[model samples]
Target: MVGAEQTLEVEGHPCVVVDRAAMQYRVVTSDSAAVALERKGTSFARRLGRRRNTVTVRALHELSLVVERGESLGIIGRNGSGKSTLMRLISGQERPTTGAVFASSTPIMLGVNAALMPDLSGHQNVVLGCLAMGMSWEQVNAKFSSIVELCGLEDSIYLPMKSYSSGMASRLRFAIAASIDPEILLVDEALNTGDAQFGDRSMKRMDQLREQAGCVFLVSHSLDTVIKMCSRVIWLDKGHLIMDGDPTETVQTYRDFTGHLAKGNNISAVRIRDEARASLQMTEVLTRGKSRRSRP
Candidate 1:
């Protein structure tokens, strides 16, 4: 007789997979984890006085999840919920301190001021990034036009990315990456940097990718985008996987959590505000960073 299977720990929490047939490994977070910003007080000796520095640790105990083919997934959580860290670990950019991460494909992160290159032009970087991703020159050529058109950078495709606006750079990066057709794509709030018009176009391209190729793991604070674009959403808080189910439900829960912070609840409002601003911009415009939006 086949009994019920059990949830296993990947990082530090227990994880259970719903669809075992389509995945080799799932990115899961254990419910029993700390999402708090625990600080260790350190003293630095100064000529004038001793200054105390508070260092915050964003730790995930155990998280396990399965990302299967053709799945458009959303990761949502509060300001120190360890959402971004999980993405980094899953994408092979960052290693978890304790547990393991299993990825079926390479994952890439697109963040503001990430400084992937401060010296290269957008065109030069496109070629370089594609090559780095293991795309042959011939393969890049085949996908070149489609990538340019999708990013709407026909006029500025040749511009030095440093001279281009942040939005322009973001569009170009997304275009090149999406066109590469990786088996797995990790997006960290890059689309929100785009203009409203571009956001619509980007969403369409993402839909095409899901229909034509593989899975996409999107970590954004925008509930609206998650609900509209993703088939499923997962919520994390203080490095804990608090909710994993429908996009609508997960997003709503996330919103409520933010609202609580805004109202000065038991949560850390300052950190939440910063996290929401820097990380959730894909969900909403960041009033602090660059004051960006296309003019009407």
Candidate 2:
């Protein structure tokens, strides 16, 4: 089961807390032939029997962290490293399989796969996206031109979103989400789709958000961008948080680990990873006037 608790913490509050959160999914390890047979109307009892071989895939291990207001935190990791899972949990889009996420406000997530209508034109999507973010009609209208300009879609704004390229759609999604100036923002790989000019604009927008005392969480593969934009960085590997600290040190360590892997130096990679895990400082979670430390 997953759970989210909205804390009374506000934009100017001290911190956003993720308290010993973890997530896992039960996967049935049935063969393709069995799946085909089930799709072809196999007996319910037989399907149930096949499903008995279920495996629990842990997406995140008891992860605990704190983010202060007005700070930009970057998350870096390899694919399937639980970065997206943590973002989804923070945004309340999904619940942790165990533990809880407490936030000052509902985080607005800007992802490459944000929910926008493919059949609708970019113009319509901007309106719908803004409204969905709790913006009034007047607010949407006021920000409409700015959003289109930031996306730099120009005439293409009239085209159906399904006809746009992935980059174009990503830019529009980012523009719409940024227009809201959310108190808590979660960005996942949306900046990777834009060119240098758009990247500059996106960076400036995030800086402005931070200046306004909002908290920002960025999940990106671009270590340079993470170091340049984030005040702090956290590294996750295989569903566990391995390092958290200054952007430069954490990213450099991650780079070294990956470099070892790229050169097929599994032994060196494992050594570096284990050393980081061993040195990690666990976070403390407070509940009902009692405090307990949580392991990552």
Candidate 3:
């Protein structure tokens, strides 16, 4: 059963491979990571053994960011700093509950639940997935050659995916997702497993994407990728936006801030105070639509 399940080994292990550049609003969403979350709920048991539950996570405060065409915006933040959450929101898999996210076109989310088929074999699944992504049968048939070529999994593309190795399965998933010429593609740390050469090839693909296609979002921990591949960056801290600027400047600031906080100084406190100030500034600027790039 090694190759029983169809899997794209090279690009299969390297899911989310295209790494295409965003041409317009590639990072068009506003850089301000403004969100208002409200966790309000009450759970109680009444006389009849009936329980009541309320809803939470209402942060209606919205920061509308427009990822301009041809821009690469990187999201940098600590774990649980709402980086993944923001990615999900941006990908349109989930609604903002209060605000609205209107992309110029549909966004393709790689890590979102749409990349795989549970019952279908990997090879069969690839064709089905591509067609489902708005591609006509002819286009799917035509691109199948290139897709399999880049994925490098001709033999394994015919087996059931449930049996494929983790790496192999990941690569196949990426190959299928990329078959579509997505206008806006969302990737969430889906490439941290591949080797160096794979990374290089993927980067090349992303460059082509930006040059030929449209915009893309890469949510990853590789600062090198962010620095080397991205033209701009956005920093998030504790669900609040820390900064939005040039990658060189912003990544540097983020690294320093991370170091300061890791060293257990007054950095967290400083950041908290800064968040408060930033909130006020957001109020002023958002209310007027004239931001001064407030900083702490």
Candidate 4:
């Protein structure tokens, strides 16, 4: 049996299927892995022993999950909890150190810091970014006006991206990515960067994207945002999934864990952690239901 596994459902149907075996891998610490090689022949064995004690970090261990179409999935965790790393893996920007990630379509990532060129105007960057994402020149031209309007950049769109504030850059990037209406969208803290008006519009767009059978993964530090936007939420702590269920219950449990830690209640924190682990339902097999046919 796999070390960890889970089933994903969207509405009453399962549109996306994921069944994976346990994945294990290690990452060498930066300090130790970057040390200059100074071991001579006589000290080789001694050096090897020292290397084994490297201060390594595990971004994720034995992770297995499924995400289906028409569901907006929220991932919440504190810093160093592997949220961005998981997004990178799903977007195909980085391969997992072990195991594999499969998707029905290419995932588009809307990051807090977009990869737009600082030297290029926002207008030029929009065209360039769309093209880089595989939109044809003609498509970019057709959508240029709508993209600019969605970003609300107006004449400022002519200015270089370097001149824009961080929020502006994030808005432009989100507008460009959302314009694509990708099948799998991965968002990382981009929503909080926009104003309330823009946030409302963006939320509407995301809703429309889901209505069209697309899947979205949002990684946010804002629990309120996750609860408001996602139908299902997963709590990940220290690179391990602590809970996965209805947004309200999972988020509350996560909040309780953090609250205990904040109050210096080690006993309560330990108790909560133990209970969460015991409730982990990691192994699941998807079968056919009234709404859809099962996969082989």
Candidate 5:
């Protein structure tokens, strides 16, 4: 039997007919590394067996979002706030323990850990990465020079990937990922690794992606980068989405909370968090009510 369609609404924003729509990830937890090693039969030294400690860590919780074409959406949060987890979910690298994610097309994700063969030269990796992204060999050949130029890695492209610094590798990866013109591009801290000139080129390429009727989801710890590149932003804390709206306002709210918390003003920080949560709850109610009314 066919299952019912699962839908999600974000706040009270106008019903955006998303090219990609209604993505949600339920609370998912994983066992600690020690338990994982035992499961993998790596070592039996501890011999805890069935009685082993198996603590679960939740990476993401109840995240519902819609992304439309021509939109550059920024995902911002403190470290461990589930930004990368959400991107992996959207990219089909990980399945949600509950709920579902829907997108009209496959998403290309460029991460700091993007795969490249350490033994292979940067040029060879580009050819391999492009082919992996579904480009024809001819297309790879055609895009090679432009990709090299975009990465500003003209000389290093001939060297083994192992010889390149982290920043250089990140630049080459970003260039390859952007060259294919993916319908949905998920960038995870890739831009921050590049130098100023490279950053400018990458941002322009992202703009080109948006202008081509594609969507870009950027996850970065740099609030300045998020505000500058994205028209809309989502603020996540402890895996919960506190706000998803205008970039400036959302960033400001996040900044205020972090500042108070850093200053050891626990009371003020808690108050700010409570207020944001209340606002989010009210928006959820309004959005759900509207969805119900619109349904048959």
Candidate 6:
């Protein structure tokens, strides 16, 4: 079954297609300390104990969505609601447990926690990061100054990454990720890390990317950011997609639901959630030689 799920790129499409995708993990429930204690007992006292129970955790549940060229899509949900998992699946970092993901090009993932060598100088890391993303050394050299400028890391680029603040690192990551002019970009909570000036610069860069017929997927908890940067938004709750539509309407509904949850009004929250789920329209997924419709 795992072999059946794959991420493939379709030539010349510049879009993303996710069909009935789901991700699950099995976790053992037994306490490791207790198991170790039992193992240390004498043979006579080591009669077979109950087997450890394994439970399946669904990180993403039958999610299906399409992102076309020039579309900036925002994904919103509470913590542990599968936002990051969905981004991984879309970016081809992880295969879905059940369905398949298809894209026109390899998606570049930029996040606040993007991995960079802490001990290396920021300048060295930028060159290495660009190289890791398949950039030629000559290309890296040509774009090196521009990348640093976009990140607004001046002489500080010579300092070790560990010496930089969280916002500085995030800016550097974003600069590197955007340097390639990726046809498909996956942004996960990275924008929230930057200050207002950097945010303006980042938005302009994203706008240019979209103008060139690219697609972007953004996962952020900030409702205002989603409403401002995305033309469409999808709301997910507990791994289920609750709503997909205009950014303003979808975000407003999600905000109302969370507000109810905060006020200890689970009943109202559930009602809003169900209503949103029921209102979601079916999404059509286009494949190489066929197309199909499914509810998200």
> Top model by lDDT, which number?
2
List, residue by residue over 15-88, the lDDT tens digit for candidate 1: 12221111122233333232112212323343126233223344554645655666788988766677777777
The clash count for each model shown is 18, 0, 38, 1, 0, 0
lDDT digits (tens) for residues 1-296 of candidate 2? 01122222223354468887899987786666544644566576766676365556789998677788878899999999999999999999899998888988778787656699999999999999888878999999999999998899999999999999988988998898788777788888877778899988887877776666478899999899999889999999989888888999999999999999999999999999888766663221133123223322
- The residue-by-residue lDDT of candidate 5 on 1-296, one tens digit each, is 00112244443222122222223432323556645654575456654554635534567765566776667889988888888888878888877766667777777786556599999999999999889878999999999999999999998899999999888888888888788777777888877768999989988887777566477888988899899889899877777777778999989998999999999998998798779767877776776677789977
Question: Whose TM-score is higher: candidate 1's or candidate 3's?
Answer: 3
Q: How far in Å is the alpha carbon of 203 misplaced in model 4? A: 2.3
> Which segments of model 2 are wrong by more than 4 Å?
1-13, 30-52, 281-296
In order of lDDT, best first, we have 2, 6, 5, 4, 1, 3
TM-score, structure 5 vs. true: 0.81
lDDT (tens digit, per residue) of candidate 3 on 8-120: 12212211221111111111222233211111232333323522222233222234354666667788888866677667676765655444455667677765245576567
TM-score of each: 0.67, 0.82, 0.70, 0.80, 0.81, 0.81
Name the lDDT of candidate 5. Answer: 0.75
- The C-alpha lDDT values of all candidates are 0.61, 0.81, 0.59, 0.73, 0.75, 0.80
Hey, what RMSD does candidate 4 come out at? Answer: 5.5
The number of the candidate with the highest TM-score is: 2
Model 1: residue 103 alpha-carbon error in angstroms? 2.4
Where does candidate 4 stray beyond 4 Å?
1-53, 282-296
Q: What is the lDDT of candidate 3?
A: 0.59
Q: How far is candidate 6 from the true structure (C-alpha RMSD, Å)?
A: 6.8
